[model samples]
Target: MTKQIEESYQLAKQRYAEIGVDTEQVLADLEKVKLSIHSWQGDDIHGFLFPNQELTGGIGVSGNYPGVATTPDQLSNDLSKALSLIPGKHKVQLHAIYAVTDQPKDLDQLEPSDFKYWVDWAKKEGVGLDMNGTFFSHPMLKDGFTLASPDKEVRDFWIEHGKRSRAIANYFGEELGQQSVNNFWIPDGYKDNPIDKLTPRLRLIDSLDEIIKQPYAEKNTIEAFEGKLFGTGVESYTVGSHEFYANYALTREKLWTIDAGHFHPTEDVSDKFSAFTPFGKGLMLHVSRPVRWDSDHVVILDDALIRMMRSLVRDDLLGQTNIGLDFFDATINRIAAWVIGTRATQKALLMGMLAPIKHLKEVEINHDLTERLMLTEELKSYPFGAVWDEFCVRNNVPVGTEWLKEVQTYEKDVLLKR
Candidate 1:
C-alpha cells in the first residue's frame, strides 16, 4: 500500500510539473500534507459545479454583462448550442435570476419550461445546476429584498416566488436536488447611516427559515446563504461573518455560503474561513478574484492570499466543501472563464495538498500562531482548533523549516498586500 501511495505521489508530482508547478518543492510539501491529512480521508466533500448559462457564450441569453442581451427565443437557441460544449458532472447555476421578463406580479413566472430547459441543457452536457435568487426582477424588489419597498406586499411577492421555486424544484426532481435553489442573500439592511430598519432584516431571516423548512429543503437540496458585505445597502444583514452565523443560528436547517470577495475590502481570505468553522457548517465557497473594491471575477491565481484559502479548503481544515466559480469575466468567453477559474482553483488545492509534507518552522512571534486562524473570539474560544491541532500533532508534523514558508511568504507579500 505504501509503495502504491508513493507511486501515486510520483504521478501527481509529474502532473504538477507538467502544469508548471515546482514539483521538487511540491513533492516535499506533499509529504508534510500527507502526514497532516491522513485521518481526513472518507470525507464527503469532492468535485465541483459551474453555471451552465455561463458555458453558453453571449449568443444565447438575455441578461447583463459579457453576453449580449437577446430575446427569449434567441436565448433558447444560444443556450441549446452552448450546452453541447460542456463535459463532466460540473455544478451549474441558473442565470435566470436577472431575467427582466414580463412577470412583475408573479416571480414564479419562470415556469417548468424555463427550468426544464436548463436541466435538459445540463443533461445533454452532463452537468448540474446551482440555482440562485434574483434581485433585478420582481419589479418591487428594485432596491433590495429585506429593505426593498418596506411594504409587506412586496416582501410577500418575493416570498411567493420562493414557494414557486421550491415547487419547480419538485417538478424537476433529482436534477434540481443535485444542486439547490440556494438563497438568503437577502438585500436586507439600510443605506446612508448604518442605523434603523431592523425589522426587515429579521423578516428576511424568517423568510429564509420558511424557505428552508419547506418540503423542498432536503438533505440533497443544500440551501446556502451568500453573505454579502455590501451592494444592496450600507448595512446588509449577513455582512459580517458573525451576522452570517447568527442568521444560520435562527434555524439549524441550512448551511452558509462564503464569497471570497464579500468581506471588508481589505479582509484576508484565510481569516474569513476561520470565522465559519465554529458551526462546522458545510461551506459553499465562491472562487473569484477581486479587482480593487469591485468583484472582477478574473481567473488569475497570482494572489497568494486567495491561494492560501484555496489550500485551507482543499485541506478540509475548514470542513465539508461546496466550492463554486463566482467569476463574471466580461472580456473572455464565459465557458473559458469557468474552465480557467476551475483549473486555477484545482491548482491552489494541489498546492495545499502538498502542505502537510512541508516544513513548519517554529516561530516566536508575539502571539500564538493559531491565533491567526481565529476569525472571532467565539470560534477561537470554541474547541475547534484544539481538536484540529491534536489531529496534526498525532501525525508527527515537522516542527521547523517548512515549505508553507513559500505559501505564507507569497500570501503575505504578493496576495494580501494592497
Candidate 2:
C-alpha cells in the first residue's frame, strides 16, 4: 500500500509540475500550517468546572453519543488520539473553564497555574496552545447577557474573565514558543427586540476596552474578537455583530475571527476573508459546517470549504490568518468527529494548494476569460486526492479510510469502557 501511494504521488506530482505547481513545496507548506483544534469537541463543551450545570447563554451541543470525556485528562486523551490520525503537528485550543486544577476557581480567579497540566501535556505532544474565554455556561450569565449586561457587577465578572484568559494565553505562548490567539466571544445579545439596543453595545465596547487595557507582548499573544449574527436564544439581536467587530478590530489593531457558521445559510464566510484581511491586523477563522442557522456541524469537503481554502491559497492570505476548527457533533464518535473535521479541513487546504493558482491569475490578468473558466473547471478532475494521500503517508498518518479503523478500535477499547 505504501509503494502504491508513493507511485500514485509521483504521477500526481508530475501532473501538477506540468502546470507550474510545485507538489513537493505544496506539501512542505501545508505541513507548516498549524490549525488550532478546539478541545470542546472532545467533551461537548461541558468543561470540568460545571459539568452538571445546564449549558446557558444560548450554547447547546445536540445528540447524546455516549463516551463524552468527563474529565480534563479524558478530554486531553481524546485529543491526543485525534491528533495522531491527523497529519502535521497543530495547536490545541482551550477555553478558560478547562483548567485542570485541584484548587477551585471561577472564571475571574483563573490563573496560569490552573492550566499547568495542559502546558505540560502540550510540550510532551509537540503542539502549541490557543485560548478562549468561556463566556457561556456559568452563573454569571444573567438574563441571557454577559459583557453587555445592564448590571455593572455582571459585566465586571466577565471582564476579569477575559483578562485572565489573555494572561493564560500569553503564558502558553511564552511556555510553548508560539503566539497564542486570545479570542473573545461573548454571548451577549437580546432574545427579542428590545426598546434600546445602543446601551448594551456601549457597555460591551467599554467592557472590551477594559479587558485589553493591560498590554501583553504581541509576540506572546494576539487578541481577537468574534462576532455572531445570532445564536439559539439570541436569535433576534446579536450585540457584537460583524460590523461592530470589523470596525473594532480595525481601530484597535486586533484580529477579527470569521466563524463560518455564524452567518446566513445561503452565504458563506469566504468573501469576508478577502474583505477583512486587507484592513485588519489579521483574522482568526473558525471552520465549521452550518446546516440552517449557526449550527456547528462537523466540516466536510464541500464547495464552501473548498472556496474558503482556495481564497487563502490563491490570494496568499494564509500568513495573515490563524486557522482554527470550531464545531461540536455529539452525534458521532467524539474522537472521530475531531479527526474527521480536522482532516477534512486539511484536505480542502491541500486541494487549494495543489491548484495552479498563478496560471489562473495570469489568464485573468490578461483578460483571457474563457481560458480562466476552463482551467478552473479542469482542476476539479485533477488527481489531488492522490497527492493528499501522499501527504498523509509522508507525515506517518493513516491514508484514506485507514484512520477510521483506528478510531473504531479506540472506541471499543478505551471510550466504550468510560
Candidate 3:
C-alpha cells in the first residue's frame, strides 16, 4: 500500500531473517489463525431473551454505554462493523440467549431453526459460527446453580439444555463447514463456605455424562467445559474449579476451556497449556483482562497475553487451541472494545511468530543458560511494530491508530443515537 510502510517491512523482514525467522511464512500463518470474537461485547451481554432479565448467576456487566444492540439484526450489524476493522477472517461466538425466534420458547426448546439467521449471516460474511450454552441470567439460575443443582428437576432441565446446545453446535459446523465449539460454563457454587462441595461436583459429573450421552457427529462439534476460580456471589467455592475440569477433561477426552480471568491474579494460564496438552484432547482459551479479580475488563495488549501467545507458538499448540474473546466492557464504545481486543490478540500472535524460538530452544538444549537469558531479553526490542503495520496494510485494515478515527465516526453517527 504505502511505499514507506513497504520499505520498512522489507528492512524488518531482512532483520528477522538474520535470526532464522521467516517473515513471509509467519504472516501467512497469522492470516490463517482465526480468533472467535464474542458477540456479547456488542450488546453488553444482554441477549434478546426476555424483558427485564438481569444478568445473574455470579457474572455481571458494569456500564450503561449507549447503542447496545437490543435486536438480533443490530447485533449482527455491529459485529460486522467490528470484524471489518480487524485483520484476517474470523468467527463469531454466540450465546444461546442470543437466539432469534418468532415464537416463545425456553432454552431446552431452542433448535437450529432459531439460529438459522445466524447461519445465514455467517455465510454472507464468509465467517464461521461458534455457540455457547447460556447458563446464567435466567429464572433457572435463581438458586445460583444449574447443572450441579441437587434438585433432579433443575439438573435435568440444564442437562436437556446442554444437549440442545450440542445439537445447535453440530448444525453450525455442518452448515458452515467448520467445527463449532460448544463451551459449557455454569455458575454453580456458594458465596460462603459450604460443607457439600463434593455433592455438587458429583452431580455435575453425572449431568455432563448424561448430556454427552446423546451423540452428535464429532467432526461437526467440539465440546468444552470452562471452570472458574470465583465469581460475584460464588466467592467461597466454585464447583467447576480448574482442578475439577482439568481432571474431567483428561478423563473424558474433551477440550479444556481456560478463561484468563478465571484464575488467581498471580497464576499464568500459559503454564497450564503444556500441562493439559498431554492428556486433554484440545484446549479452548477465553482471552480476557482481569483486574485483581474476575472483573472481565476489555482485553489490551499486556505482558501476560503476549506470553500466552508465545507459549502457544513455541509449544506448537496453536493448531490445537480454540481461541476466543470473553470480556464485556460497557464503559467504552462496545464496537471499539471488540476491535481493540481482537487486534491486540492478533498483535500478540504476530510477536510470538516473529520470535527466534528455534535459536532459543537450541541454546537451552546446549546448556548455554547465559545466552538463552540474554537472547530472550534482546528479542523484545526487535522491530515488531514495522512487521505488524505491514500486516495491517497487507490485510487492508487501518495501520496503527488510524482505525480509531473510523470508530469515532461510527460512534457519532451510529452509537450515539441510542
Checking candidate 2 for backbone clashes, the offending pairs are: none
**After superposition, which runs of candidate 2 have C-alpha atoms over 4 Å from their true positions?**
none
Summarize candidate 3's per-residue lDDT along 348-372 as a digit string, tens digits. 9999999788888999999999998
Give the per-residue lDDT digits (tens) of candidate 2, residues 1-418. Answer: 9999999999999998888889999999999899999999999888877778888887889999989999877888999999999999999999988988787778899999899999999999999999999999898998988998999999999999998999999999999999999999988887889888898899988999999999999899989999988887787898999889988999999999999988888885898888888788999999999888778899999999999998898989999999999999999999999998999999899999988888888899999999998988888999999999999988999999999999999899989999
Give me the displacement of residue 267 in model 1, in angstroms: 1.3
Across 1-418, the per-residue lDDT of candidate 1 in tens digits comes to: 3344345545655544443445455333322321011000110111011112232100112123333223333333333332322212345555434232333323546554556655665576555556555433234554444323457776666676666566555444475445453544554444555454555556666665565566653544556666666653444343223465446643564666666666676777666555665565566666666666435454565664345555474445644556665555434443334434544554455434433222122221445456434322222122222222222233333111232344345334532332
Point out the worst 10-residue segment of candidate 1 by lDDT.
Answer: 35-44
Which TM-score value belongs to model 1?
Answer: 0.62
Q: Which structure is stronger by TM-score: 1 or 3?
A: 3
TM-score per candidate, in order? Answer: 0.62, 0.99, 0.98
lDDT (C-alpha, whole model) for all candidates: 0.45, 0.91, 0.90
